[model samples]
Target chain A: MTDPSSASLSSAETDDGAEAWVDPERVSLKNVLLPLLTFSVLLLIWEAAVWQARIPAWLLPAPTVIGEAFADWWRELLTHSLVTLYETLAGFALSIALGVPLAVAVVYSPVLQKTIYPILLALQSVPKVAIAPLLALWIGFGAMPKIIVVFLVCFFPIVVSTATGLTAVPPALMDLIRSLSASPYQTFVKARFPTAMPHIFVGLKIAITFAVIGAVIGEFVGSESGLGYLILVSSSQSRTPLAFAALVVLTLMSIVLYYAVEYIERLMVPWATKT
Target chain B: MLASSSLEVVTTAGSIDRPKAGARAVTKIQIFDLYKTYATRTGRTTALQKVDLDIRENEFIALVGPSGCGKSTLLKLITALIKPSRGKILLGGTLLDKPSREVGIVFQQPVLMPWRGVLDNVLLPAEILGLDMTEAKARARELLELVGLGGFEDRYPGELSGGMQQRAAICRGLVHNPSVLLMDEPFAALDAMTREDLGFELLRIWERHRKTVVFVTHNISEAILLSDRVVAMSPRPGRIEKVIDIVLPRPRTLDMQFSPEFKAHSDEIRALIRRT
Candidate 1:
């Protein structure tokens, strides 16, 4: 006697009334203004400390001296900075390309997971920096060594976080999909992968920071170009202010990459429940 | 048995007296000699034992039992989500070997994909079913409207209230137009008022579609109110203890809940549930 189809159909209607998605406005002047003001205040304090304390310039150059050095070598440092950025981005992209598919493969196949996981853990345990010299010798001094080092630093977190996310689906959630009689492939595409996005972003964010570090490390041990090379040159010549400027630029590059990743995470996973 | 013609006349009269529809079809679901056991590092533990049941088509049956009673496991078995250690499940006179598109499931949590909007979550099954996306989206909109969640089509699951989220989940389950809806305490996370509202809404929908539903719930009152038959279960090597039939009239209302018949059914089911 019941019209089961209509009942289910209208119950679907009941849900349609509650959804409310809105476009959040983008970052505005107020956002940039606050941070800029804070940075200025910090700079002013550093300058005042140097002027008042009369600290030896060799040990800790004044803000004015660092600023002058930054201006003096702006063109040269910018070129090197761009090279490092290019290496970092390429390495990060490569890590994502390799890591995500590998994570998926591991999640879907237990045999592959069992054989590969322990090996990965052991590989991660080996200090990557210690292997940098050998890698340089093998690959030579072109971009390859630096890119490989960056890839090494950035790949693990992506794979680990992505794998965790894929596997960490709650049992109840799986039940919801299972009862639907969803095919294994359907379940993965519709439920498991989407659920893993936020976790993947976490891994990517961490890896990006380390990617920059890896590129710098590659330059530190053996490289003809990059901010790292500039650091070596400035430090050896006892141009501490120039070294300080290079260091500042390195920190700024890392921060920019970190924030860029964070921004992408926000865009890609706005509905992240944990956040 | 009543004479066929006379039975038809009687049913017609009974239906006229009622305000809503009745079962649209009879779906036979049989669980014969079902057994599930697990061998942990500690030892062997049985989850279900000698469970036998025959569910007639279009019956809204509620399974109520203690934790670890294998109620969820039973649902899993029927849906072919897991292989029974030894047993058989028959739907419409055919053995259930794999998960079928004829069944829709709503789990305890909303479990809506956080990255998908409300409408997209509801359309998930359609996507999986390889159904037409445009048609599915249109149907999804209608289903959302039925649940009183209209105009919320674009919102993410995180933006919805608990009750609202569950409502969206229910829409997702029913969207694929499956013949059977399996709910594992789908409203358990909701507040009392929301639970009551959803219970009635679910009944209204069931009345319209008459799909066979097997609901798992811990709430005695909920089981009594929603089910045509309440299957009471016992824990550890879980067994079906009793099956109590509700003979109350159709289009059951909140007022009937206060009537003697409703209370008697509730009390009897509660007593049976506590016996274990």
Candidate 2:
């Protein structure tokens, strides 16, 4: 309701006509240093608490111990991370490949929407964890099973978001396009699709996080590789630091992928996402 | 039944007023016995009850009415956005039975695609119409200049003021060069000064293009200032209550709006609307 775009656009424009908000000199060092300093203090407290309390290293290992475990198993951790990354990437790609077109079809055709949308919603509601074992059984516990499980997890959000984006065009906008004698496809490509980009990105970002978790679940069910497998192997052998190291890598992977999608969304929909 | 009979008589009477050009009547648009009804929760409510009108080519005709008087509905019917319950709308010599590119519509809102630059926004119609990209781009640049948006071509709709955005919408509407330009309160959202400026600007554009414009507005003065003829309508079962002809000379400006002639016509329309 507020004309936020106008306010922001004008404020961000500098006297010399450059966008000054992105200037490093304007960004306070405190903004970066404060967060880092706080995190370091928390880590020190964690190490001191463990030592003073005489806690077993297996229960909650110190940062130095975790670093040692990380260095010792660096090769295995990196290898497993790659496998998980590939599975997640493959599943994410396949889901997008299948979901976007299917969403377009569903949104464009009432018949397909009426028939398939409810079933898709039902699939999403079903805990995909329950189906991991069945997938492992059918796909023979290789990358295929993990990939399929990840695909199932990621597919719904893309479909739902894409469909919503397609349908969310303002009625006035549609009328404006229609008055030009625009064909259905042209209306979609020109007006509806661009307008829906922000909403579609919402679904994509949500799916990316779930995609990582799904890949981990696939590894948990039956896998010779992946962070999930490493965590399982380390915990079974009381190698908590090793498991903690695998977890740190997995969290980093998820955050990095999620932010990557966010960055693209920002670049593409700069106008719509001013809020 | 009585309304339907009267509607038939009105349609015939309206056609008789049509000036024939060398035995070939060159009416830009013809609405014969137009009626539109909406099925509401309670019952069927008649929005427009058997309306008939004949618009001459290159004439600026204003359809002014009260709220619920079906001015917007009539505009939609003319643009082929909605079908009439019983009637025929003819554009040029061809009956506009379906939505076609023959008419360009400017809605109350700018409705520009926010994601697109001002240049791209103006080219929206061409994109949807699938015209030659190079030609459309050329025409879009021309239109941007025509609308006084030459320097701000790369700016997005979000970057423009409300007045500028509406101006861009006008460019988009006229880009396709349709014979009939349908405007539904396009300047109603603008401030007073901007709206007046745009009204004169539109008049200037109309003089240059000489296209038939069916302008819909609720403001009596706007209708009187811009229209060659002002058709006033009643509320509810929308019916044409009066039609006042402005025999004022061409190239009328903002000052003309305060002239005795303009005020007289404006008062005439105001009285007619109030009576409705």
Candidate 3:
């Protein structure tokens, strides 16, 4: 008991120390001001360096120019951002919808896991970027191909994490449940699934971060309208500022989606984030 | 290893209050020549052999041994979490091949789900057993109160101290009101002070609502202090070495441990363990 308790500190009290508890989610001015200040300083340095050097606009646009382009192409940016967001959301949703159930199967069925795991790992090895063109070629340049690429990138992590969480139920907890004569399904619903929630959210968060990148890659391969397409067309046409604006929008989308998952995690599994 | 075709499993040390022949009716758990062996890479390791014991209804029996002793294996066997390699365990005279709802267990760790609140954690067994939620919740509240965790129902396991968490775990073990409560060194993880406090708390809880308890601990004083009888076992091929009935008065006080009788019991147990 002594050594085992010391060993499983990760599962033990990693967080709840004697230090007074701070609500992790509450937004404070000190938290926002530091990042905001750093961002402003970086942007100022870039803007000043660009102005002093008189760098060619096509080579690198100043923050002001990017901001101007952002304002000038507001309508276009909004349309493209919405399209990219749709693909990202759709692809991520698909991954989660398919991935979680697949994880449960992998955890429960050894035969299924043995058969499918190697194939999954192999597919993971083939770069999502490499798969994008093939996906586009097969599906013929639409939201479907981009969504599939997004799905591909998001799929592996979700399944891996979900499976890990599902299988990593504390042995003592399993014993306790076993002592109750809980049916497999009952054990799953009552114990395994809830135990896996924090872990599942970890996968979901990682997959969500990849979701936008996947959509952009799909658009880069071949697409009509999206931030990826906008960046591609604008940069090829020497609309550097416009492309930068699109890139910025994509980044914002990624951050927003990541936070959305985190917010959901905080809401659903409040006990998990206590650390 | 000595060759012995016939083995005497039960060893009653000093004076024992032998129950009448009709006492079989009160026997909640009957272990008959129970053996457990684990097939390891080297060879088959016998964890327990020819262990016979009868735990009476509401009797508090503590199984004490050093590390590698099969006290834990015995507890699991009684819970039917793992089947004995040989012999049999009968719970209330029925052959216990699989774990039933009648057995409740608390491990060394709290094992409370971090995600669940204290109330929900306590009510888990009730939920699993398909008991009435309302009644179970009522009983759960009562139990938490019994353990002095009355106002902490909404708190998560992480927010509680180690002793508090174990107290909640005890509440959980007793929530379903199981006939047999198997605790495997439940207080061994806490600091010495918290361990003692929780030991008293457990005795208080056990006294009010009695259940057949088989408490396993390496702590000699703890086993002696909490149990009605201390079943001391040896290591390696784990078998009962001696069973000493604690004749200490009810509502056992800490001062009783300093008494000559307690010292005599501890010395005898210490000697038996050291002889190996």
Candidate 4:
């Protein structure tokens, strides 16, 4: 059947000329502009409130003061930010390397799933922040503790998503491969894995944001470096503006990393987005 | 009387009693008292019981019945996707234990890999079989062209219409040059016009290839239009009630479906199915 919606959409485009064609672009522009405008208004009100109330800089710094503090300590902040970025990437990579195979095993073997799935769920239920201190105690205060903690935090989501994805093959698709007398390995490599890619990416997206939090928590427990440590030191020293600057940098980093996963997902499995 | 004994007698007698025109046709598949029982959490349900059929080479047979008549179960059994509880399936006089390369299957859904383009999807069996990729690619291209999807080879499954995807799936089932093609309600998901169009396309392909086809469908007209034999099945404890031979001549057209002979065959099968 001719798609009624698409037929109407094309007709609307024709009737409205370039305007209908540009509708999505216009919406995207509004999306960005509206958010920025709201943020600017909030910042203006905060600045006016701080100034009019004669609040001390140590209590609540104005937006301009925070910006100036960010510029003044940009070099130090960049160094600490790089440290946090490294820990996040390293831990996230470790999670993928370990979690995927574990997920595969869980999906393929009922024995392993029955035995290990509960353990994983239990482990995930435990507050990750509680384990950070133990990890720091065991691995020492270097990058190792931070990386391990990040790995621990990111591991569960990847494993769960991967397992779900691997097992979610449609019965029809499974039948298609099986009717070919395909070896189990061939079935997995060609059909199951490719089908699971979108799901795996979803896990990666969630795990990545958690990886940032994990790294920061690792820093909070022990690390002498990283943006988390910078925030800790600045706030303790009553350098509120510098702490806000470090927090802002950390937020930007998390956004960048999340999008990076999304970008790769688009490249690897473009077909998934359409479905 | 055991179905297996009768099946054996029929297999030998049919080969010996072949007419001069049918002399070259040999038995391609022989099912001896095949039975399938599914064991669920509750208990066991018999899907097919005491089914016996002998399929000739290059013959087109259609399995038609009400829903849950084990038409699909029989197809799966023939393809060796699932094991039969009791019976022997012989391919060219050899006992079949697993999915054989000589048999290809098309399910109700196209089941095309969304990631792979149409050409790659058709070549999937070759890849799984580890055949020569270069030759498989050439055959894939020819099959695509044959199916009227000549220029759409590079397109993904999502990009194609439902009918086009099913056509591509049919090309996939035939790409390996299998001797027997098993289709389980392949066009059941398409619109009426698309189904008719695909039916004609399938007949054209069968005319050229002459592969033994075992098609399962609920549509009585579809069975009469495309098959040399229509096997009517009973529901629940699925059993072959009757096998009606269509005497309609080859290269059958869509208009032939409205003919008096075709109507007689259709009515006869419908009555047989309704009786039980």
- Which candidate has the highest lDDT of all? 4
lDDT of 4 by residue, A60-133 (tens): 99999999998899999999999999999999999999999999999999999999999999999999899999
TM-score of each: 0.86, 0.89, 0.91, 0.92
Q: Give the lowest summed-lDDT range of ten residues in model 1 chain A.
A: A19-28
Question: What is the lDDT, from 0 to 100, of the residue B270 in candidate 2?
Answer: 82
Interface DockQ of candidate 1: 0.33
Q: What is the DockQ of candidate 2?
A: 0.36
Which 10-residue span in candidate 3 chain A carries the lowest summed lDDT? Answer: A1-10
Candidate 2: the clashing residue pairs are none
Error of 2 at B212 (Å): 1.0
Off by over 4 Å in 3: A1-31, B1-25
User: Where does the lowest 10-residue lDDT sum fall in candidate 4 chain A?
Assistant: A1-10
Tell me the spans in candidate 4 whose CA falls farther than 4 Å from its real position. Answer: A1-22, B1-23
Given candidate 1, what's the lDDT at residue B124?
83
iRMS, all models = 7.3, 6.2, 7.2, 4.8
| Candidate order, lDDT descending | 4, 3, 2, 1
User: What C-alpha lDDT does candidate 1 achieve relative to the native structure?
Assistant: 0.82
Chain A vs native chain A, TM-score per candidate: 0.82, 0.88, 0.90, 0.92
Task: List DockQ for all candidates.
Answer: 0.33, 0.36, 0.45, 0.42
Ranked by TM-score from best down, the candidates are 4, 3, 2, 1
Q: Who wins the TM-score comparison?
A: 4
lDDT of 3: 0.86
Give the per-residue lDDT of model 1 (tens digit) for B27-92. 368777789998899998899887777675677889898788789888888889888899899987
